[model samples]
Target: MPSVGIEGPVVSRGLDGDGAVEAPPFGNANEIGWYRGGARPGAAGVAVFVGHMDTRAKPAVFYRLGDVRPGEEVTVTRADGRTAVFTVERVETVAKDDFDAQRVYGQHKRGRAEIRLLTCGGAYEPEERSYTGNLVVSGYLTRTGTG
Candidate 1:
């Protein structure tokens, strides 16, 4: 996603025992994690991508994810050599405590291939050492090409 200065291989990930998606190891901060249990990119459902905003010492692959704006494009080059381009529809900062999992990760359209780029955002709470919310960028497939 050049629009947000993101470029890296997506490692397949799955849900943990508690049913929450697993994140890439902190050591691999430069890589993005894809929820493999869900719809594949360019398929007719929501595809999720997660990455870290920053590592302990420096910014990570999705450090600039929140900078992406509506109307901008996010391109995903699939492992099968096809490319799917999506147009940014909305960028939201959803509070962690108030997050709606279905709303944020649900398909936007019945037959459209959509995606959500997610990373931590909002004010940092020192006591918890965690962000207050998450940055969610929702987009739908707009173009496809064989790369």
Candidate 2:
């Protein structure tokens, strides 16, 4: 997306039996992973895209995601060659422990196309090999165009 200034293949990620969505590998920092079970971009639901915030030695594609502000534009190119244009509505950082499944994954409004861009945030724990919080950017579809 323009705000992030990078783009890569978005692979489908499915939920496991525990109903948890698996994140992309750390080595694939350049690409984004889409929750295949969630709404597709430009569709009437929440489409989720996730990327790595940082690696052990360097920053990843979404290291700057926390800096994105409301009103910024986020564009997603669909497999059908159509572009889904979105306007950022809000940005939030919530602790992983307090992550609200319903708020993040639930549909906000009926018939409204929305998206969530997610990445790691807060303190990183070396022992745990994970961040304490998640950086989420919520956007709503503003328009569509040919890619």
Using lDDT, give the best candidate's number. 1
**Clash totals for all candidate models:** 0, 0
Predicted candidate 1 versus true structure: per-residue lDDT over 90-142, tens digit per residue: 99999998999999999877888999988999998879878999999999999
If scored against the real structure, what TM-score would every candidate get? 0.95, 0.92
Cα lDDT listed for each candidate: 0.90, 0.86
Candidate 2 per-residue C-alpha lDDT over 27-61 given as tens digits, one digit per residue, 9 for 90 to 100: 88777889998899999999998888888888888
Q: Best candidate per TM-score, number? A: 1
Lowest lDDT sum, 10 consecutive residues, model 1, at: 16-25
> Which lDDT value does model 2 have at 131?
89
